[model samples]
Target: MCTVCGCGDGEVKVHGHKHHSHDHSHTHSHSHDDGLHFGDGAAGVSVPGYSQERLIKIETDILAKNDRYAELNRAKLAAQEVFAVNLVSSPGSGKTTLLCKTIEALGGQPLAVIEGDQQTQNDADRIRATGAPAIQVNTGKGCHLDGHMVGHAIEHLTLSHGSLLFIENVGNLVCPASFDLGEDCKVAILSVTEGEDKPLKYPDMFTAARLAILNKIDLAPHCDVDLDLYTANLRRVNPTIEILNLSARTGEGMSEWITWLRTNLAQKQLQGAAE
Candidate 1:
């Protein structure tokens, strides 16, 4: 598995639509930016014994390198007055669906997307259909988007000053919490179909997020999920996290989501003006 954050299989590869031709035939060495190798003790990288210490060091080094790149990305977004948000969730949590609806609600506001997945540009295509500039970042076997990868993506996307940029992180509640992509906020999405106890189960992800979107609420009547339990669990993990309930499929409670975005955007613009 990927030892960088213990998220996926070996060798994290980035596939950017603007720069790559989707070729998997290239030959290259697989290593984190800090020269640490991936996989589980293979390739003579991991220690034969006392493996926990070695893994800890590797994780530390990788995150340190990732943080440096994240700072650079943060600076770039700040300079442009762009409000960047990272969307993190497990698979089938309705992140892309929410993003598509959010883009539509944005109504041609200056927006761009950085879609992440282990494979496929399907999410990027969906965002593009909403008429927003989008770039797909296939992370190969990686379960998270590091700052270095997002920094490269920024070079290709045309983000306007005071605009909104969304980075849809790979579908995983675990590893994505360890890597920061310099987003202004991390929005964690959990659908009702998923258990209400998810926040309790994945405390790290919930604790890392600044806001929580309890989506697919329209189906709540059909599902056995308890909204109160979800909120309580979320608060238990992150007492200060803001939450918005909505259904992307039916557009229910979308107004509140749009208002939240606009409010954040306005604050960003105000800060930019003051600077």
Candidate 2:
């Protein structure tokens, strides 16, 4: 259970299927029975609980520990010159499909993926079919991927230096907003089939994201989503957030998306070199 979001208490398994020489991918599941219970107010101030100050302290302590882990992960990535991106969205937002398309577009590029889900290695399998290495981090009941979990997930897979690591977060926007997985950017995906007012409804996710991908544009004609209105709503929460409209199915506007990714990656490499 993630103390920050209280998503779930399910088990997390890192599955790395061997596909290459650098691939340490193996089929093994490890259960973590840590005593940290963030859910049910495990902060120890329950029922006729302790003072509000004590409650606040517990929350702060939890976040602080997570932050420390995040910082450590960031340092490790920096040491390897890996540009990590965190993908966050609601369920069925077409994030996995879009990633597969992106991987194909980035053919031959050094890329790795960290797939986060409550269960199933399905997404990781899809990514592997694209000829890229991927690690599946089953978050069990956890709604979001915290830094500590990500750090452990990285340990199981071998990511290339100067490569891009895509961390596909669990399919929930709210809880993921607060947890930092040491990503260089947070890209939120909003499908056209969903309400155009989603940005306003889920302000935390929208505001936390650096880019918002308005996916499924191929179905825009059949859907009721208003592109202009959606953009306006996104701006209301995040004035500087970049927005991209693309349909992973039709490959329309995909060049722009790929170009954006390459540009960011180049910038990251330059920064790493300078450092």
- By lDDT, the best candidate is 2
Candidate 1 residue pairs that clash: none
Worst 10 residues of 2 by lDDT: 24-33
Candidate 2 deviant stretches above 4 angstroms: 20-47
Positional deviation of residue 102's Cα in model 1 after best superposition, in angstroms? 0.6
TM-score of 1: 0.87
- Per-model TM-score versus the true fold: 0.87, 0.89
Error of 1 at 267 (Å): 1.3
Judging by TM-score against the true structure, name the best candidate.
2
Question: Where in model 1 is the C-alpha error above 4 Å?
Answer: 1-47
How much is 248 displaced in model 2, in angstroms?
Answer: 0.4
Model 2: per-residue Cα lDDT over 40-158, one tens digit each? 24434353435555545555676677778899999999888888999999999999999999999998889889999888889999998988888888776678888888888888778
Total clashing pairs in model 1: 0
